[model samples]
Target: MDRVIIAGGGWSGCAAAVQAKKEGADVTLLERTDMLLGTGLVGGIMRNNGRFTAAEEMIAMGGGELFQVIEENLKHKHISFPGHEHGDLYDIGKISGAVFRFLKEMGIHIYTKSRVLHAQMKDRRMINVTDAEGNCYSGDGFVDATGTAGPMNNCSKYGNGCAMCILRCPSFGGRVSLTSLAGVQEKMGRRPGGAVGSMSGSCKLYKESLSLEIQERLGRDGVAVVPVPPELVEDHLEKKSCQQYALPEFRENLVLLDTGHGKLMTPYFPLEKLQKIPGFENARYEDPYAGGKGNSMRYFAMAPRDNTLNVEGVDNLYCAGEKSGLLVGHTEAIVTGVLAGHNCVRRIQGKQQIILPDTLAIGDIISYVKQEMDTPEGMERKYTFSGSFYFQRMKEKGLYTTDTALIQKRVEEAGFSRYFSHSGKKDCVS
Candidate 1:
């Protein structure tokens, strides 16, 4: 009852492990590659738009361990970019080590290079999981945070092939879903015209390769927007997975954020064309190494789950991050991860698992994304707190706010102020 095994060590999986450990469980986290954080290695944007409200909500909810780390490591704070405001960017170069140290200090068992490829289930509950190395791991509960990116095959079929982003599919093998391995039928997201998956909306560039002016500007402002000449602008927004960044401003300019590496906000920009733009003359792709063509693909496989984050048809299986519906962004993933991990322990404890009341932003999104993901139209779009439809909805519902004290009060009003702070006798209060 005290053991939990979580597959995948991205931001969500890491958060899940943290919550499970805090719940007094012996947690074991398995990651596919040599390092952790997965796509988070290339992602550093935080607190932009409704994300500010969501982050504050989580902090007040007692799920702020990771958020604290992120804030401490942010290279730039309170910055703005095209279609986004009050954003912060973490130093990608230092984040992996910092997060790794935190997890280790918490005494969570972390096994890198442990890609879970198989699972053994008894009745409706998972008994154990086996990594690609043939090592078996058993626990009282399980979580599938293995994200929805590619394994080479899906990218080639659905995207412009693998842009070789941070997932490092070839080196460590692509992502393998624990939900699918448990004999559950998984769902795949589709594009507007019935395409299989969506292309990742961003790529990393070597900052040193940029012109002195651009580099200096990024250092000073954390964002550098250079207008793309009319002819140099290539329209790949249709293929972008991050609908949040698919604004006209993104295409009108080459928006770069300082996340250690220059984060280019586009599915992929052709190098030859990108070079034609004024300061990007010496620009180079850091990740994927072929940003000229495309980037990593996502939303290939999602697990069907309830608002409580339990995988349907499985008694002790839970999911988070991209595996949990079409929810995107680190904020979205981290919150879902906390819920799934907490619920896994609650289920094993034989307590009635709790669902966040939609009064709070985190809770609302948990239920909203699940409901939206059920329709044909909903499957075509990505949901995040940062921007686009979901963010708009947050504002309309009075769920979006940046006031820290107000967010704490809102969580208190939702009756989950410290729900994740420690094990609870009841759902709302510990």
Candidate 2:
């Protein structure tokens, strides 16, 4: 029996474990936290990426047939709230819960509150891992779906900064990070349709350092800012232990603050100092995740891009979902998880490799990450807008996938085209 060990039980970790088990590998998942707090670890930021739409035309004409197929399998419905406009929000927690249920149904061993301390590597191959409780576990192949690339971090700390690359600049284009708050009023009053007020207030600011200034200006209009910062933005973060905080999850009719900036933007400075900023005062503490402080960063929270998934030094170990570090949203995470899962199984069986949809941006994303690590010389690294720069590299490789085209198409279809314009000179996916 092939034994496989997985670290972290968040979306990515759970997805990976399920996939590995399906492939006939005995999978063990280690989650540092005891219970699954679907509640917002930091102000329910996970609940609101808003609605990200891909172009239906592209999805149809392109090789992205799987995109449509998987999306159709997902459940979506219009939810109404008092004093707010009701729109379709994908029940992401449900999707994650489904995976967890599937894992349990399969009889996989799930270890909660067991923190994997370190991996014992022999000849650069991971042989065993030690947890916080002094329990030593070994496996045939280890799936490091640890959001912050936990195993890779241990390896890099002892070895050279191998298996990962941390971009220092806070202003990565594709990524953004911001805090949000709830407890606001509906301005438009109640309408017959559902609610007259908007469900969420969008944050216009882009920079991490200017987050407070931007929030102050926006919050004055009844908008709240959730305080979720990237670890790189905080100075004391690297030195001090992680500060855990309890956060409230949104249920029916829950008002949430804007987290557009804090969750997506990469932090320029150390993220620890940002918590000490003026706005985050009186923020209470909650449960901590397995990977600690760095993993909690908004950018990392979106999705991780550790070199584990990339075709590099290691051969047997395969990564997927948020742990892949390239995926940002739930749909992408699940899709990639499926792809990685299917492909890893096929590869083990010595069958043909599963080729990703080249037409879709997601496909290009995985390929681009592989290319980024290939040269290692003067990689034009910049966080333009979340992971947009990576997509831009894919463009250079002849892939014309952009969130703008897809998002704009949806906006136009929804009769809100004017709200988004290319002429504004401010690129959403810059």
Candidate 3:
């Protein structure tokens, strides 16, 4: 019953809360916005490319509740899109509520609209975190899943002006980094050209805004690929946070996915230009009201952490999601969050923390990203299991696989079968 306070209730924070609860810790998840799944509120893609293997690996390790929730709420499964295959698009409209309910059912206290603005530290350990309302949340250990999305200033300084993406920083106050608050020096991810932050790839479009032809194609096949006119195509691929989707096909065609709302595959398309395309005459953005301009900027503040996700130079704080590194995607966040949560609890109990072995893709990426981030070149790249350089590395290292049984065996061999499910409670919260 050790108290574990988690900041930023995105996918990673939710995953950490669940795993920490399973490890017999009293968990409290604080989110800046009113809803769960920060940037993930707009993102619906899962089980695509190497993510399929990564998801199965987490399931085998007994940390699959979130994935199960996603699977149950999936709108389309095993569908293929440009540069991605065997993908699952969860209902973005339904997923946030579903995940929130799942965490509550597991006995984790959730406080939305509660943004942690300051941290009280004693020596090297965090004593408590004070929310915007001055409410103090004290914990034995903490996890910072507060992702690297933005606080308006970063977006305006780095990319185009605020696109009003799902993070809704304008409404809930900008993302405040717990690691930075605790006196730890954080890092910023950069584009290849050394820009400060990367633009959020993919924007959501109102389904009804699209024409009948494109709508029908998306409904039937879960994806619609319309060729973009040569003159209308805008190339913003290199500035994309999700480099996995930066492809010639994405530039040449308007690839839309059925995620309740239409998931536009580019970061942001000009509204005027989008209207010129066939079947998109009435296209309008659903998430970023200003999708015609730009999307949310991400990777502005990332915490330096070890492979176990413990924030370096801090005794009682752990970090996950984008805070853990330049890692993107919901699956990456969930996996890192699970490990961080479990390890945080173990640290509280004075037990040795566990790190997944390189035999599995999850472990490999965590260790590999930490190693790569030490160099200047690695900071310029974004990592995700879906696609991009990491996906290519997965293929080269034989870590990318669609076979569930193979991933399960790898997890079992790593001695992590039901690792997050060990239960021994002492009511340390009082």
TM-score of each: 0.98, 0.46, 0.98
Identify the superior model by TM-score, candidate 2 or candidate 3: 3
Please give the lDDT score for candidate 2: 0.37
Write down the lDDT that model 1 would get. 0.90
When summed lDDT is taken over every stretch of 10 residues in candidate 3, the lowest stretch is 421-430
Which of candidates 1 and 3 reaches a greater lDDT? 3
Give the Å shift of residue 215 in candidate 1.
0.3
State which candidate, 1 or 2, has the greater lDDT.
1
RMSD of candidate 3 to true structure, Å: 2.7
Task: Tell me how far the alpha carbon of residue 400 in candidate 1 is from the true structure, in angstroms, after superposition.
Answer: 0.6
lDDT of 1 at 208: 95
Best by TM-score: 1
The TM-score between candidate 3 and the true structure equals 0.98
lDDT tens digits by residue: candidate 3, 211-232: 9988899999999999999999
* Tens-digit per-residue lDDT, 210-320, candidate 1: 999999999999999989878777888888889999889898988999999899999898898888888888989998787899888899999999988999999999999
lDDT of 1 at 9: 93
